[model samples]
Target chain A: MQPEIQPAPSPASLAREDDVLEAAVRWRAEGKAVALATVLETWGSAPRPVGSHLVIDDTGNFLGSVSGGCVEGAVVTEAMDVIDSGKPRTLEFGVADEAAWRVGLSCGGAIRVYVERID
Target chain B: MDLALLTALNTERAARRAAVVVTHLASGVQRLVRGEDITSDPLAGDIEAAVRAGRSGVAGEGEARVFLNVHVPPARMVVVGAVHISQALAPMARATGYDVTIVDPRTAFATAERFPDTPVIAEWPDKALPGLALDPFTAMVALTHDPKIDEPALEAALKAGCFYVGALGSRRTHAKRMERLAALGLPQAQLARIHAPIGLDIGAANPPEIAVAILGQVIGALRKPAPAREAAA
Candidate 1:
C-alpha cells in the first residue's frame, strides 16, 4: 500500500539560510518594502561564503548577514536607497576601498554584494 | 529580485527541490531555474556545475556577467538500526550538517535515554520509512544485522534512489542477501548500488570507529563526481 509521506526535516543550518529569504517574502507580504542583499563574490578569508543573504526593510529592520557583523550597517543604508529608487546597487567591501575603511571586513577579506528591491 | 521570483525560490526550497537564481549584476534582471529545467537553461553548463558543487558565484564576464545563487536541500542520513553505532553516528552526522533520524522496532534499543538529542522512532522500517519520504538527498544505512529488519529498509532505500545505501554484513552474508533480493525481482544494476560490508575499509574494530567509516563513505558518495560514484557502484 502507498503510505502517506511527509517532507524530511531540514537541518538547522539550512533552515537558518532559508529564514532569510522567507523573512523577505513575509515582510513584503506584510506591506513592508523589502530589499535583498546577496554576497555575489568573496576573496581571501571571507567570514560568510558566497550566496549568503541579508534582507532589509524600508524601516531599517534586517535579518541575516552578508559579513561577520561588519559592513551590514552600510549594506542596510544602501538597501534603503534601493527601496526608494527601485534600482539595484552593487557594493564592494574590502580594506582596499576607502569607503570600506569605514565599514571594513575585519577578517581581511573582500566581498561584492548585490542589493535589489523586491518589487 | 521580483517578489514573485523570491516566492518561487522559497517554494522550491520548502519542497526540498534544488533551484538557482540567476541575477544579472549590470541590469538587475533575474530569472529562476528549477532543477528539472536546468538542462534547457541558456547557462546550463555553468548552472549544472554550480548546482553539482552546491556553490554560488559570478559567471561570465563584463556586462554579461551574472551571479548564480544555488539552493540545494540539505543531505539527510536515515539509520535503520538504533543500535550502538547509531549512538555514535547520529551526533557526528548532525555536526557534519546532515539531518539525522534513527528507526528500529525494538523499543528497548531505540530509547530516548540511549540517544539523547537524537530523534529515534520506535517503529519498524517498513512502517516508519514510508512516512519519511526517502528521496535522492537521503543516505540510508541498515545496521541491525538482522535480515528481517535490515532487508526491507535496504530495499526501500534502493527503490527511492537514495544517494547512499549501505548494509552491515560479511561477504557471505551479503552474497546470500543478493540472491534473496534478486529472487524478489530487484534488477542487478539496482542491487549493485548497495554497499555491503558497509563503510570505507578503514580497519574499524569498534562501533564508533565503524560509524566513522560509514560517515566517511556517505560523504564521499555525496561529494564525489557522479561518474566516479557510478564506477564505484
Candidate 2:
C-alpha cells in the first residue's frame, strides 16, 4: 500500500510577519488570486505597526491582521476590489474620517494602508 | 507585488536572511533587495539605517513616494544552561519578542516541566548548537559555570558571529576562561568578544533581577554600534 503523506508543517522559526508573505506565495502557487495589504504609516495608538501585513484571497479569505480587528473588515473589502481591478490603492482610516467612524477605528488612532494585487 | 518577487522574498525569509521590498506606491512597481546586496543599491543609506533600526515605513514624498518593507529575522536567544536564572530569563525573553531556547546536557535541569512553554534541549552544546544555525541575529548566554558545557557553546557563538555572547562568572573566573580558550587555539581577539562577568553591573540581587540586567545588555549590544573589529565582517 502507498504510504500516506503528511503535509509539511510550517517551521517554528518563522515569525508572524514571515507567515503572511509565505501565505501569499502559497496562495499564488495554488492559482488563487491574492491581494496584499500593508500598513504604510500610523499616528497615535495604531493597532498594528507600520510593517504589519494582511493578505486576502479572491474568496474573501485572509491570513494575518493589519489592525486590532477594528479595520480588517474594511481592508479586506478594499482588497477584493484590488484583486479584481489589478490596480493598487491607498486607504486611510481614523476617527478623523467620518466614513471610518462607521467602520470604527475606535482606538482613536490613524493608519494608512497600501493594497496591491499579487500577480 | 509580482509573484516572482514575492516568492524570492519568502525564500530569503525562510533561510533567515534579511530583505527589503521597495515599492513605488504611485506606480505599484516593486523590487526586492537582499540584505547582502543593500550596499550597492541606490537607496543604500536610507535602507541601511532602517535595517539597523529594524523598522519599515514610507520614504520619499508625493511623486517619488515609496515604501521600504524591512524584513530582518526575529532575534533569537540560546541560553546554554537551564538553570534557575534561565527559568526566569526564558519567559522574560519571550515577552520581549525573542525566540528563546535552552540547552543543557543535564536532563534533570532541562525538563519540559521546568521550562514550561520554552524549548529545552537535553543535549550537549556541541551536538545541539550545530543544528541551531547560530547567526548574527542570535544571542548566546552561558550560565552553566561548567567549562565542559559552556565553553564549547561560547566557542560556537563566537565563531558564528552572534551579535551577543555573554557568560555568567566573576572577573577572575573570566580571566581563567580567557587563558583556557586561548590555549585551545582560538585567537585572543575572538575570545575577547565574550562578555564575561555577564550582564550589566546593576547590583542584581536575585536570578530574576540578573536576568533583567542580562537582557538589557543584550538589547544594548543589538541596538548600539559595536567596536570596529567586531563589525568588520
Candidate 3:
C-alpha cells in the first residue's frame, strides 16, 4: 500500500532556517554566484507543484528540488551554466528521459522548472 | 541582524497570525538588508521606524515569495446547509481538521440542538459570514443549493480569496450562476477559479461519497509534493 503521509513538522520557523533557505542565504553571503530554481508549473502526474523551490549554488550545492530525483542532476548542470552566464533560465524534466532509470525515479511526469539568479 | 531581535519579531507575528520573511538584498549581500525580519509572519508597529533602523527588504528579490514556509495547518470549512450532504460533509471536513461551521437561516434546521459541539449558525450566510475570517487559507462550500442562502456565502467567499471555493449544483445551474456572477462584476478569471463541477472524476454518487470527493480535491489542492529526494523511501 502507498503509505499516506503528511508534511513534516515544517522545521516550522523562519528564524531557524531550514537547509534550503539557509543555503540561499549562505551562498549569497559568501559571495558565491548562485541561482534559485522554483518549480512554477507541472503537468500530468508531476512530482511537484508550482512554488516548489530549489537553491543551486555556483559550485552545484543543491538545496531544494522540483521533481523526484529524476531531474536535479541535469538541473544542477544547467544551474552551473546559469551561474557562469549570469542568466535566468527554465528547464523541464520528464520520463522521455534517458536519466530516469539511473535516478531510480518514477518516470512518468513532466515538471517545468525556472532558474533565476537572485540579485 | 541579532537573533534576539529576529526571535522577538517572529514570536509576536506568530501570535498575531501573520506572514514573516527574511530577505537578502542585492543577491550577494547576506543578512536581511531591508524590509525583512526573521519571520514569514508579518509584524506590527512602526515599520517605518524599523526600516529606518536598517531593516530593508531585498532590493533584488522582488515580490513576496514564500520564504521559510510554515504550514499553518488546515483551513476551516464553513458550510451553510443542513441538508443531507452537509451531514456527511461537516464531520468529514472536521476530521480532516477543518474547524467546521454549519449555517442555515432556518432555525428548526440549523439548531445546534442536534450537531452538539458544532456551531450551528441559525442565521443566513450574509449574517454569519461577516464573522468567519475567510482568508486564502479558508475552504468554503455552499451545500444548500438555494439561491438566497448559498449565493450570499459563495459571493463572500469568492471575494475573500478563499483557497478552495465550491458550490453544489449541476452544469445547467452553474451556467446560470456564472452569468449572475459576471453580472455582479466578478471577473471571468475569478469565476474560473471556483471548482464548480466539484470533486475529482471519481464518479461520486450520493452525499457521503460526494463529500469525500470534495475533501479529496481540497487536500490535493493544498498538497505540496515531496522533495526530489527522500533518502531511499
Q: Could you say which candidate leads in DockQ?
A: 2
In candidate 3, what are the lDDT values of residues A1-119, reduced to their tens digit?
99988534423433345545455656676887777776645667877655466888878888777786667887788888877777666676666755654554475776667666665
> Where does candidate 2 stray beyond 4 Å?
A1-18, B227-233
Q: Could you give the TM-score of chain B for each candidate, in order?
A: 0.94, 0.91, 0.70
TM-score, each model? Answer: 0.91, 0.90, 0.49
TM-score, A chain, model 2 = 0.86
* Candidate 2 per-residue C-alpha lDDT over A1-119 given as tens digits, one digit per residue, 9 for 90 to 100: 99999746647756343488888988887899999999999999998999999999999999988887989999999999999999999999998999888888999999999999999
Q: What is candidate 2's lDDT per residue for B1-233, written digit by digit as tens?
A: 89999888977887788899999888889999999999999988888878877999888889898899999999999999999999999999999889999999999999999999999999999999998999999999999999999999999999999989999999999999998889989998788789879887799999999999899888878766556324521
Instruction: Score candidate 3 by lDDT.
Output: 0.64
The CA lDDT of each predicted structure is 0.91, 0.90, 0.64
Assign candidate 2 its CAPRI class: medium
Looking at model 1, the pairs that clash are: none
In model 2, state the lDDT of residue B94: 95
What DockQ does each candidate score versus the true complex, computed on alpha carbons? 0.56, 0.64, 0.02
> What is the DockQ score, from 0 to 1, of model 2?
0.64
lDDT per residue for candidate 3 within B1-233, as digits (tens), equals 23333334344433323332333222321132122332232432333223222222212235433222221323678777877777888888888777888889988788766676787888988788887668766788888888788887888888998867888889899899889888889998788767777676689989899989888876655442223111111
